[model samples]
Target: MGAACIRERLDRALCSHPWIDRFPDTLVKHFTDQGSDHRGLLLSDKAYTRNSRPLFRFDARWADNPEVRAMVNYVWKEEIQGTPMFRLWERLKRLRHLLYDWSRAGTTNSLRNIKTLQAEIERIKLVHPVDWDEVRNLEFELNRQWEAEEIYKQLKSRVRWLKKGDQNSSYFHTVTRARRKRNFVAGLRSDNGDWVTEELGKADIATNFYQCLFTSETHVPNMAERVDNLPISQSITP
Candidate 1:
């Protein structure tokens, strides 16, 4: 930061074999210093763009809603033209779309509602003649929404050992945030030694890598030859 500070260089990129295999095209670019004494280094790759669908996760909070159950029942009853397994898959696929739409239209945003209710309650209390009835009603609604928010956090945190009665919403929130941060893949090295930071590039890299990894490169062995080579008597036993 200053001349008095001993001059030293420690900036470097460290990656393992698995990481290199995943993104062989990883490239590092250096940039001129803007304000800091140290210059900036960016890992990047050839830009790529593609449309991707968001992943669907069934919210546990939906379990408490009767409408969700009814929707699922209605979807499950539909006779789809397919094998048993295919029919089940089709039913689930249809149900997911319906549930997604229902969830989008439903009052799922408890946190915002909780804050609004709290503000309204505070405002009512400031009146010269306190409206106890209104305050009580708002307080009840606030608690209900707060509980729903807590349940949402609890499900996200995935703390199986923690009981629902133990209302540690803040703890659950912290755990959920930490898990998401740890699990998130910010960037990936491509085969060309460039970092794939864009969502589309990263997705392509991962998909290609796994596809190659799982694909059978060797030709299928002859079953008859393998059976004849078995460590057993060829003639019938006496």
Candidate 2:
């Protein structure tokens, strides 16, 4: 039987049947159809066997823990060192590697290690208690560093894609446009009353910018219209 059907049957049998005490963790055995033209039976300890297959495991409870959030925050704080802004950029690289390993192993060893360190700090607090505030501050700083690192990595990935001429897709174009708009706005602001010479020249730049914007708007719609108007047979094959 198919895997889902097998699981459903097994679930019913397990709940109702008294003979079947426990299900084996491993597969029973592979069976072939014989000349009798009948499906092979799956032999288990309990009842008559039928064709069976392995079921995929799903564990949802592990993802919903508050401790997971606390652990992540703690690990992030432990990684931060100097100026939060600059340190975030550097720490992001390290965080990315740790995250990859966490995914592959399906565990958070790095976060767990940080928790152990935090526990040690707590123990020291019991003895002296003077540096407790300092310890807490350091932890907060580390978490901020990790947060900044994550933001930097996400922005870096988007920037890399933009640099690679990957704006053909609608989603890519949308992201590129937003990034460009944000950077342009940020560059235009000045601390003093006087504007930068480059900023003053934006009037000249606006003409070319608007021209390109209009061209893109016109072309994208025309391309979409053309695609929509094409014969279905020409776009698809039997």
Candidate 3:
């Protein structure tokens, strides 16, 4: 069929379909070419899919606990004392980095070295299998270390912001949103299989605060309600 006739047909179909709103976003078009013998029509629609899974979050409040602090210190000392497993891991890490550098430099020798190291590691694993429980413990320890580092960084950043005497409300709001997003993503996978998106609750809280702050009303009907139980102050009475 001619390009003009195909276009007209698609236009008519779009007009006739009042229930198009129910359907996903889509488009129909005719393609005419100088080289090709025939004209073609294409229809496209968007596919909806679930979001990626969120990572775990460490409890920052745990840092304040004496027992947790002691455990973290003990772990650090043990790591410093370097077991045979730690040596092996360090070697493996160095070898991997070397291979990466070589690959980026486009060197065949580096590529060969990476393959050799990988094969050797696999062979060792096959010969003497590592304990799954030990692996899990190590992974958990690594995650804890990373979380501690992040907490330190965030605290430092907050301190710096405070020292600068910058009372930018937007900055505080951004940090608050980030914390909420992280919390929501963390609570996603509980004991049950259901996915819980915490943003719904946080959104309500945020919206109320935003309206209270921005609205022109001189008296925002007990501003304490808008702050969501945050400890601001009680009162200044002589």
- Number of clashes found in candidate 3: 0
Q: Per-prediction count of colliding residue pairs?
A: 14, 5, 0
Cα-based lDDT at residue 5, candidate 2: 50
Worst 10 residues of 3 by lDDT: 9-18
List, residue by residue over 19-67, the lDDT tens digit for candidate 3.
3434434444457645765457676555433354332233453446565
Q: Quantify all predictions' global Cα lDDT against the true fold.
A: 0.74, 0.44, 0.45
Query: What TM-score does candidate 2 get on C-alpha atoms?
Result: 0.24
Ranking by lDDT: 1, 3, 2
Residue 22 in model 2: shift from native, Å? Answer: 5.2
> Which candidate achieves the best TM-score against the true structure?
1
Q: After superposition, which runs of candidate 3 have C-alpha atoms over 4 Å from their true positions? A: 1-53, 56-61, 73-159, 163-171, 175-238
Candidate 1, lDDT over the whole model: 0.74
| Candidate 1 residue spans exceeding 4 A from truth | 1-53, 120-138, 161-171, 185-238
lDDT of 1 by residue, 1-238 (tens): 4877786654656665455446645555557666866777888754333356665689887787899899999998887885565576568869999988877875778878887899999999999899999899999888888778767776889877766446657767666655653465668999999987777788789868755544425467999999989977767778
lDDT (0-100) at residue 227 of candidate 3? 88
Question: Against the hidden reference, what TM-scores do the models get?
Answer: 0.51, 0.24, 0.19
- Residue 163 lDDT (model 3): 30
